[model samples]
Target: MEQRNGRRLILLPLPLQGHMNPMLELANILYFKGFSITIIHTSFNSLNPSTHPHFTYHLISDNLSESEAVEKDLLLLISHLNRKCYEPFRECFASLVSDASKEPVACLISDPVFDFTQSVAESLKIPRIMLRTGSASFTAVISAFPLLQGKGYIPKLDSRLGEPVTEFSPLRVKDLPVINSSDPERFFKLVHNLTYQTKASYGFIFNTFEDLEQHALATLRKEFHIPIFPIGPFHKCVPATTSTSRFLSQDWSCISWLNTQAQKSVIYVSFGSIATLDEAQFLEIAWGLANSKQPFLWVVRPGSISGSDWLEPLPSGFHETLNGRGHIVKWAPQKEVLAHQSVGVFWTHSGWNSTLESICEGVPMICTPFFGDQMLNARYASDVWEVGLHLENGLERGEIERAIRSLMMEKKGDQMRDRLSKIKEKANICLRQGGSSYQSLNDLVDHILSLESLALIKHD
Candidate 1:
């Protein structure tokens, strides 16, 4: 259902499912709004073409194992994208623009990570906008150009004592979500990737509500010259237009089960894809969830419990005892579960999508960031927004139980909840017709379209 806007654009997303999904959604919206979109996928993400035949797909090989990408682990592939994907990517863009079969690229909308894409746009002299598929607070943190490398801000996280991040705003570092960087080498590279790429992007768009992070948004607007647009939930702006086909079905049974529980009586837990927990970590989490005695729903993806037959050994018949009280499943529809009345809190991996989704639902969180910017997300959640609490590094059961109980039952949880609901209200206002985010998106579309008009006028 693509309307003919008589203009062409390139949509480049990173190589992960989370990145691709939002990129696809935005592309779909752009197409429906009448723009021709050429989506570029990494050599590793070539499966996208088969999955989405509607968009024009170009597969460019990068540093990842080319002939067969499945042979390499994801982190290696991501690293390769950072180190070696640029040159091939440039050649591909150049060729596409010169193809003559299609319109010249009027605009380039790239992922936040592919900040290098701005270089491509510059070479072709087309306007570019970086599409950040995450929270406003996280993007603002990057935009702030925080002393991410220095102490008192960067390396001083361990000593934070859950205290406030000074001069940041109404929020503190302790309330924000915190993720653990698995290996030092990868963490630094990823941080460099997030910050440098953002600074390099022409303009950037975030999938978040502006009202929720006023202080952060103010800080970012002052710091960066690139146009910043907050058009989100992103789900709100992008209709389910042609629900891209995928085999996964969200189980609704959990929602029905949740309905039977008391108001905000349940603790909802999930660690997101790509996070792993050993048997000990798994048991600790289980024991904590069990001890809360509050009814709960936990989505335990396969391999979450770790080791074959792992969940079997937990607390000797723990499942049977807690069977009626707790419902654990391999996978459940996260969004719906969050919206359910029974859910009071989320125990999460501090992933951007998960955090934003929880906030959108007005549910608080207990964050344990696994790696990458998840730590940044956790820090903001606890320190900045006051919407969630966090666990220290140990990942022990007592810690898990205590945190969950306090966040769900303690007076502190009530205070956090009050602040969080206010944020959610602000979010609702931003989604209205004339809100900043809505206006920003309208301007973005017009901005891209006008570039082509300018080129035509110059030729005349």
Candidate 2:
């Protein structure tokens, strides 16, 4: 596209914090490549002060009346994305495309959840790409969902002789792979919807690099014709540039605590924004951390533990024992903490964001996934990437302690660390000049620009 003609782009992100965070990165990458981007958000999400805050922030209603209704319409939530988010976006794009200050909007890049976007792109006859925003292992899991029965993992939904969900991928229902859905049934429905949408997208943009996920990458290339571009380590693509805070990214105070720790000495534990533990779970995790006796930073979100008086009261003496050895805060600047020299390991919920962050930092993981495809992501992180340990499915203080201790001093920990360190080098390389991610990112930009150019040609 000629520089004077202007190239305009439309971006749509999932409403959740975890979902919006990566899409924003992709947008920044597009802007750097010289396309004007208009990102669409949900009314539900833009109001949440805690989630990522980027894009022009246009919102749609998911439109479920109650928690029960949301459950029933779970697939709708996952795949349908609100139609209301679209009209405004369409109007915005039309205006921007015609504006004297900007180029005509040519392409649409959206999250799969926002399916209504496809129609908008179609109405304008513009190419729209979906952001996959997950790991290669995760992509493999989704691609292989129908084949899970051949290997005998999860029971077949339709056939008795079918393979289990575990056969095609390393994730399982038992340990760290599930989404901690708060409602398992609802969670599964959401997964089903996302898988279907993958097939629906014109193409997908991933926030990962090729070196970090060779097997998954190879599988996506070999098995699916769906266009999957790995243009990532998106955080690396950004130059530590600051914008107005979109979502309250954890507590900033944790940064000071991290600064004081010794190199590779502290374990960082956080279960993400939505995964809450109960009193029993909380006590188990607390006691486990105490037993490890390793320095750590733990984020304890209010009401993080379910059914607990513990929210109002810290475990007696826990603060005393943990004071110098560890620090507890509601949230922290996670990426910055992950980058710290003292972050020896991570205890996480295995959310995609957490998984990717740990990978970027080269820190080993202790995965205690709560729901979604977490079990699958963790499986790949531990068994595939060799970057982590997956705690037992039903969590225990002793199990958590044992896992932490193993991660800290055990031979397996050392092996995994060395392995992850090598992988980390690859991630760095991928984001560097002429690297896989860098190249892929450029390709994505060129593709979007090509679409915008076509739109301009059509207009002319």
Candidate 3:
């Protein structure tokens, strides 16, 4: 084995914004802890290495165009990348290992989507940890796919949407992750392989603290034989030293706009980096925000509406109706916006990262989940943690308006805020010294160092 100065880790993020952000936060945390990071990423939604000059970046060109990603079906896009990435990823990984001057690669950390890395890491004789950048509860629900399938619950019927998920406690069928496909069986099979690969990993890393998800963490440990580490709310553990925006240029103007509003008077709206809405739903949200008569900071991403470049053609006089009351941006610095005193309620798609960020900031949420883990996360936010309200029966303007008003103006919103304050305190505690998340992170480093030592001994 070659001698090296410091431990070097390789990270392969899933390349979507929601998936990539938390992984990068993990990279930041590892880098702060004296581990060198090498980020091997795909061409679509790639991170610029120059912006993050400290980390080494390797591009595994998937040859997927921006237009192709937007046009292709979500499942098809993932399937295509999985097939195309394996060879290039193998080559890049092999080259990294064979290089003599560089630090001997200690371990590989990858998003669960890149489960193929388990095999590559095995061949290269390195430890691999699959980072599940969502709550342990959400991952537990998805990991129960086989149970749902055996009970004939998946390939779910629209009629059965209200049925309670008996295998998992306190969740209804509507709370389950939606696999939008004509062939639901095939999609389930594809995801089942991810769990299979996770079981083969050296360990499992979750972006959640133990107290925040006690039962779910217990369930995951019981279900999967692998060691599980709940070492996060990573954003709080590692402060953002610079811009981490991979895709959208953030609009900082809203921070000034937020300051002008009354305390807890503004509702923050963002549906995550992906998840495009149809025209009707988009218009409904617009009218709803307008009718609520509350100040709002809305992040209308460029391609938020299908086939549209902007929300310019919103309902007639939509801007004029709430001219002084609303501030719109292509994207807002979400963490800062949530932490702002003026931001009362968050109207969100309930993506896990967004969910945790809102909780960490003690901000309550109005969940309008789109698909996949979002459904499960929305349920946890509204039901388990009691920090949010869900928007059921789809997006009608009346419902949207009422939800905004209820969360921002009514007593119900105050109750959720009180609950969130306690959760926020708990999250902070977990990341502090001698806390659960802190100890877990230390354990992770120890495990990596042990693996590296064992590998060196074998080589010697």
Candidate 4:
């Protein structure tokens, strides 16, 4: 083990699987780079400190009721957390700053969703950096939210759904980001908060690489006027560790099943932790996979199906129809699964983490975006990157089967696979010593160290 530096970084992660995974991975990366880490997390989805024994941990009460904790409305839940966690986080952060025995605090790194952290860090005169756990393309679109709203492009009128957003070429109005909020005003507020708070950060650390999103990164740099570090595909950058930041236990049995299947023959399906499906749509997907006649590994997260606890809503003899062609589990080891030779197509919700994982592994995707940046990610994968197909017309069995055949058994799929192979090569090269991500990471480390000096200058 390397000796730690005298500086410590405080990380505040929003308590969701996608958000937590990248934050923890970045923590590990910084720790290996010789900085001490302190993780201040919420009680809602608290991390197990034992999982990362090297890091110090602090749990600040979010004070959420059982109902608030289980609130299905994502925007509402986040609003609740922001309002509830502000005071507790401020107090906890103050204690860390005033503590005598710990290393001299360097800076604070937090998930951008916790916009409250900016004010807390400002109040303490701490330099704060934000870790944007999404694609640069998504961030660029988000930067345009106010303009989109002003033009009445938001609230997504049916008439404009298919019309291209001329400003954001290749993206239709329907492809714009949206939340499941009945209150458009609240959604707008959330967007404004996320965007401006990001601008307020000392710098940004994106979990993306330059080659993949050079255009988007350029746009963000011009807009935000902050030092932006596109130093990611974070899993590839970090040394492998035993501890997992996953909220659910991964079913490793799928790996065993993959071993028995033919190479590049199986379509691995997962919609991430938060996306849910109605039973009618779920049945369409089930029948679609069956009719595709391709071997598949599907992750049906316990409560992901509407009005059904698990897979009880599956039509009778659903398993027998496939007869060992399909494997279903509550959760999957996604990175491992995507890297498996048998997985040629990833049928996904197009979350940034899953999209990057698939890209790095050279697996093509079938995008079914549920909400938020997923729409943007799916659009980029299908139209921009040409790495996947987008299920544009919602869930239909016939279209699903056709898309599977086109991607699995046709020339178009082969072309997508070929393009993804080259993109994956770029992703790997960027992590090498002379690569963009490598240099960006070096710059980020230097910037982090310089924050102490910047603080002194401000004090004087």
- Candidate 1 per-residue C-alpha lDDT over 358-436 given as tens digits, one digit per residue, 9 for 90 to 100: 8878899999887656877787788667788867567887788788889887898898888878877776777678887
Q: Is candidate 1 or candidate 4 better by lDDT?
A: 4
lDDT of 2 by residue, 1-460 (tens): 2142266677777766677778777776666666665655555546443333333444544453455333423344554345445666667655554567755666678777665666666666677777886666776675565465355444323343223344454444342233433455654554566666666555677877777776678877776676678987878777576331234446777778878888888999988866767677777777888878888899887656766533454566777876688788877788888998889999998888789889878899998876666776777778777788888556787788788888888898889888888888888888888998878876776666576565555446
Off by over 4 Å in 3: 1-5, 65-67, 453-460
- Candidate RMSDs in Å, in order, are 4.1, 4.4, 2.7, 1.2
Q: How much RMSD separates candidate 3 from the native structure?
A: 2.7
Alpha-carbon lDDT, every model: 0.72, 0.69, 0.85, 0.91
Q: Write one digit per residue (lDDT tens) for candidate 4, span 273-376.
A: 99999999999999999999999999999999988899998988899999899999999989889999999899999999999999999988999999999998
Clashing pairs in 4: none
Which candidate number maximizes lDDT? 4
* Model 3 TM: 0.95
Give residue 452's lDDT in candidate 3 (0 to 100): 74
lDDT (Cα) of model 1: 0.72
For model 4, the superposed segments whose C-alpha errors exceed 4 Å read 458-460
Clashing residue pairs, candidate 3? Answer: none
Q: Backbone clash tally for model 4?
A: 0
Q: Single out the weakest 10-residue window by summed lDDT for candidate 1.
A: 240-249
